[model samples]
Target: ASSRDGYSWTEKQGLKSGVPCIGTIQPPTNLDRASTEVFDVIVVGAGYCGLTAARDLTTSGILVADNPGSRLGLRTLLIEARDRIGGRSWSSDIDGYSFELGGTWIFWGQANVWREILRYQMQDELVSSYDFSKGLNKYILVNTERAQHFTHEEEDEMMESGLRKLVNVDGEYGKRVIPFPHTAAFTAEALRYDKMSVADRLSEIKDSLTPNELSGVEAFVLLCSGGTLETTSFFEFLHWWALSDYSYQGCIDYLVKYKFRGGQSSFAIRFFREALASGNLSYAFNSPVAEIDDTKDFVTVSTRDGKQYRAKRVISAIPLQVMNNVVFNPPLPSGKRTAASIGHVNQCVKVHAEVRNKDLRSYTGIARPENGLFYAFGDGTTPAGNTHIVAFGGQNGHFDPEDNIGTTARKLQGLVPMDIERLVFHNWSKDEFAKGAWFFSQPGLLSNHLGDMRARHGKVIFGSSDWALGWRSFIDGAIEEGTRAALTARTDLAPSQLKGKL
Candidate 1:
């Protein structure tokens, strides 16, 4: 007999005593013989976006009862490709201390995500980073002969000048330096740095930078963009500045004030537990979807095992980079397919190391040509006294894991003098489920594809932090898109009006 947990079964002899035990009739072979089950909505992921959509859609006034004729208030199914929920946001114990593998750190002014944290009553554990008021020292090594340091004042001046050039291009300073998005005055201001590469823009102001200051800015750009200056768009830097009010001080302050004490993974745990308790959602783990076919009346989603699920509406919360892997009948719309094809940014390779000493002050170091590593930062106050330092290396695509660990360690040696006790790193590029850490806009692609990439298709909605209009690569954006997508779905269905007088 078939079982839900996939276990072999046999009937007890005593129950069929009247008939010969060997001749006991087998149970019905067809599992679907009872009735054709149908659901109102089928959310295709269990990430933050999928979970939020499922929760909001179910709790919104519509009710489900045993009676088949009872308006059939929105039945929802949440499926995850992984064996567990929480997608990219994960927290696990490492040496008895909580370590976050993906998506950590949230700032105070994030607005939407902050609201969700408060709504869930998870504010008590919030922690702040090292003091930002007293400017932090920045170090940079550009080849063997160019190692230098920048005072906080010099760094601030350089960044401020860059911002001024970006905003007042046609003013007394000349034409604007970048071509930012023009949706609103704010967006226009944000996009001013879009046209130029960071390296090219820096070259324009190289005369004003002291040797040490130039290296410092170069290092900062690399760390922020996860790539070298030549490849990172100048406009993206300006957009980041605009989001944080054009000041590194403001940006660092924002990051420090909105960190999670236990780590960002705590929020994921809470969300998943609450969703599971709702009793309205069902999940199929380790079940990768092979194909999706949508018709005028219903969408049929098939799994690898040939099992099929039918629903009236579907949401594709997966990232666009991996869209080609899943087959879609008649294919997704040309615009969406094109957006998915051309819109993916490069992947990231990040390394986290635990050192034996905590006395090492928190610092950020940039590597030069002679130096092996480009960036390293002391992660302050981890649960264990072991100093936690994070490094970002390699930007184009997946790197050799064995080669990466050694290369990363050599780079760290240039920054701090500590014995490396253990190391942990994740190459987001290698993960099949997530092809990259987060989506980033290439040079000219932002202007052309940003809008269409985020737009919802007929019955298949799209939502991910990568598509967020505000802080595109942040947790704040994830929550924002999740809520916005749910609202769009609810409004489309108009379930409240069909409740028949409640």
Candidate 2:
């Protein structure tokens, strides 16, 4: 049951497993034949990264002829540990309301994901989760002992002012450091301040900010750093600042404003469907890769059941923390191993709750990182007209949504003052395949290990949102890395096969 369902719900004392929109459905594949034949490229992890790579590699144009050797195009095999496709970016329907259990939200600024959205004609599916620019909604800020009401404008001002002080490391607001965030070409500038943590920077700017301003900044840090400010990198925050156009509003709008109306699962499934349509693609679900051995010419991927699949090139798209589970023959570099051991500092848990309050329907709740519930907002209303609120917190925080359901509900109510009905979430931190939620680089990570994290180990090409150049830790970043990995594999393939717009 755990293998089949990606989400769990807690209506009572313990969590009861529930199905995601796409995880339970298995796609048809010829894994037996796939194992017998050597593939041109093997993609591990059927998340957005692997799926995008498969799609691009398979559709790169093929030459057909009577002779088998005359045929062109990369034969791609995608292997997934779970029965589902999307790794952490999947959606579930709870009480007739769509809940994005993992990576959700996108914007026009995210080039790779936005391009795919346009290509798939899913632009119409995009919807704003909430528009803070309008100043129409109620915002609850709980930085002090009690919750206080503030208009969206007031909240924005405090946050904007506080962030200005926090991210302006070079007085140009990180521009001097990270002029091109996607390129990550700021090593020298970043190294100078690589040792500083988000907590350190916040402490430096706290005296300059008002109590409310400091509260807002702390909440932003908690949310952005995934509740680990003391270890989360200031350079990582600077990268985000540059990626978000160097504004607090841009960070909010780009990171959390927009999402697909049909849910991210539907969007992710489209890539799978398109990849499957290409005759060059095959896949195996429920096949967890135990080891990857890169010999002189080819790489052999061995699943837990001892089945081996050989490929000229392999794209390892799994998360950094999860990578420690898979053994490499020659072994990864010491830097990469150490980086994976440290991992990203995001042990934050995301929880979605349905509430029966009309007045609090579209409100945004912000709290101090230590307060347990760091950030939350009314995502949407259910068919029953109940408001659906999505909240995030640290794993060791006061709100234990996965356990102690009564206490979690009461704690949430203390923040938003709503009558809770149901709660749904996935514990990515505890999941074997994930081990953590979205990646937020730790101090000295970008300066010391970014290259090692993204570098290829012989024929095994590494691609993951965790190490993407631009939108790291986003669906867009997955596509960026996936597309790059596919193109890299294609370069090694026969030049005749690469005729399409890969």
- Whose lDDT is greatest here? 2
Candidate 2 segments exceeding 4 Å error:
1-3, 10-14, 33-35, 62-72, 131-136, 395-400, 495-502
TM-score, prediction 1:
0.80
Q: How far does residue 127 in candidate 2 sit from its true spot (Å)?
A: 1.5
Cα misplacement distance, residue 95 of candidate 1 (Å): 2.7
- Ten residues in a row with the worst lDDT in model 1? 14-23
Q: Provide the clashing-pair count of each candidate structure.
A: 11, 0
Weakest 10 consecutive residues of candidate 2 by summed lDDT: 61-70
> For model 2, what is the error of residue 186's alpha carbon versus the real structure, in angstroms, after optimal superposition?
0.9
lDDT of 2 by residue, 1-502 (tens): 1235454654563567656475444543556653478789999998899889889888874333333443445789999898788898988865555688888899999999989999899988887777444232788887656778888788788789888988887889888888888886676878766788987888777788898877777677767777467878888888888899999889988988899877888798888888778778888888899999996577999999888888888999999988999999899989889889888888877888887775566689787646577788878767987777888787436344666777777667757777877787887777889988889877888788889999988889999999999999999999999999998887766554433523
Candidate achieving the largest TM-score: 2
In candidate 1, what are the lDDT values of residues 1-502, reduced to their tens digit? 1111101111221111011111111331112334356656677766667766776765553333343344422466666676555566654445455445566667667787678788788878776545323224443344454455554455467555644553343463222332332122334533545556777787787776665556556656655665556667676666666566555676666543356666655676566556546655555656677777876577888878777887767777677677777888757777767767775554555666677666443455656543434656666545566776666655632353435445556666766555676665554667787777666656655655667667776677778766777776667666777777767766666554345743
